[model samples]
Target: MGYFVPVEPGVNLFVEDINQEGSKTIVFIHGWPLSHKQFEYQFNILPALGYRCIGIDWRGFGKSDKPISGYTYNRLADDIRMIVSTLQLDNFSLVGHSTGGAIAIRYMSRYSGYGVSKLVLIDAAAPTGFTKETAKDLLKETLNDRPKMMQGITDTFFFQYITSSFSDWFFQMGLEAAGWSTAAIIKLLRDEKLDADLPKIDKPTLIIHGIHDKVIPFAQAQELDQKIRNSQLVPFQYSGHGPFWEERDKVNQLLTQFI
Candidate 1:
């Protein structure tokens, strides 16, 4: 089943509550321009392995309500807090991919690991925000021509030899995301900073990154590891920005072991 947890009076966030008879839970948060559905590789597999899996479609993405505002990390973290409070989750794990990783970090910093136990960032945009001059210019370019920006992403970001079907899937996922949310998020990424929040996360943290990631540089993982004390970083040699999909087997193995 699913839950449309209310974030605001009229805004409800969609959460795919794949609850099973288990104590340890895993909440999967998707990356930019995608929804909980992006974690298709994790939800069912984790439950079968005796872990409860819940995937959240952040406000304005996936099946969640597309509100005009509240697209920043602070508000997104608050939305996550509402979900945890509503579900009464405890000793749970939060797994975030790409931009979702930043959101997860924000949540942990804000709540001090309220119901969260372990943290896993897969090919995440972390500790430091995308506030570089180059990123700013790219954001402006994306805002100017979204379709072209998306095409460029699919062509240059993913592993060089990805199949047509896989490329199409990624493109479709991007297209499915709301234009307003996408544009606002790009601007927010360029302006927001997460350096202070990094040290606040004291839980067991795992930083998984792909060496070939063209979207968010793999070097960011090193920076994240340095900031989050005792965090482990695993680099996928053959993957790109999406290790979960690019190197599914390895990503699954690492996730299963981490949890």
Candidate 2:
């Protein structure tokens, strides 16, 4: 029971909350090369707790406009800042995964928790060792490309974290919905660092990571838990990068307690 709740169309924000009304809102921001639909489970479910769960498609991803510019972390955060203030939301909570988590941290650090009350990061990307060395290498190769993107990043995107059953979906269908280009992804992966802003968070944060997560690695979550003063870390032994999809029931239980 959802429809397109629109914004100014710069970054193309889409929002959904409670059917009738809700006191608290949960804003879920999806990861890189993935749309808000990656959180389709969270949007459809989680209402039993009477929560208004909303997910946003970042610039160049999801139903959002896939522009040729404004891909910087600051630009994306600015778009989200407008969305929250426009809705006039208060005491809101945020849940972000991987790249989404990095954006959340960046937003919180700069704005100092304007509307955000609680923060939950699932397999977040903290820029501790998100060194520019490896990225500089890959991006150098990406520079030889043309203006328009022609290939899918899914083929080798999650080569390390993907399994047989999970392979066909998260990268192929899910990433396609986001509409991210190879150049956009390369730039994004190459030129962003959230570690500089993490130590300044004042809000309560929950870091969820999978022990088997090869994408961002479990140590990244540990580093976040160590740095964030009011944060806790949860580890999923059998799960990979996407714990919510891997072990949903347990992930829900952890989220229930976190929020």
Candidate 3:
């Protein structure tokens, strides 16, 4: 079942809660410029394997309501908290991709991971917020010319050997997000300090990162593993930033084993 779960008055997040009897819940958090659709692969297959999936599009992305503000990490984490509390979710795992991974880290740290059992970080933006000093220059350029910067990001980070249809779909999904919202979110990410949040995560964590990731480097995964005490790092040898799409079978197999 899917509904707009209220985060604040007049601000509700679109959440998809797929319930399955006798199955564990896995809440999926999508990355920036994308929606819950980012985890479509997992949602399609995980439930039949005795795992229910919950995917929520962050505010200003996907089908979620877009306010003029509130794109910061703390605010996003609170939104997730509202969903978990509203659904009475317990003993579940949180799987976050890209910026969603940073939000997951904030959620656990801010809320102390109240009902979470484990965490899965897939090519996530972690410990270090955006990972490059050059990102500051990019963000500046993005503020001036969003469309141009977005095209550069897509070309350099997103598509590699993927088909035309897949790449087109990615571009379409990104286009669904508002330009102002994208800028605000990027500003928050650029300014965020998550080093303290990393160690606060006291759950069994699995970090899966693509070795060839240019968006958020592969070294960040190693850094995350080092910070999170009880965490395992799994490198996707041939995959890039989008492992779930680039190496779906391998990622799914590894995820199943981890959980």
Better of 1 and 3 by lDDT: 3
TM-score of each: 0.93, 0.82, 0.94
Best by lDDT: 3
Per-residue CA lDDT of model 1 for 1-259, tens digit only, reads 8878997799999888875576579988899878888778776477777888889998888889888899999999999999888888888989999989999999999989788879999888765556678566657656787777677768876674888897788777777767788878887777888899999999999999889987889999999999997699998999888887777778778878888
Query: Candidate order by lDDT, highest to lowest?
Result: 3, 1, 2
* lDDT (Cα, 0-100) at 147 in candidate 1: 72
| lDDT by residue (tens digit), candidate 3, 1-259 | 7889999999989988776573688889998878988777877777778888899988898899999889889999999999998989999999999999999999999999979999999888877656357567667766787667766666766434867687677777876777778878777767787899988899999999989998889999999999997999999887888888878888777777877
lDDT of each: 0.84, 0.70, 0.84
Least well predicted 10-residue stretch by lDDT in candidate 2: 145-154
> lDDT value for candidate 3?
0.84
Q: For model 2, what is the C-alpha lDDT against the true structure?
A: 0.70
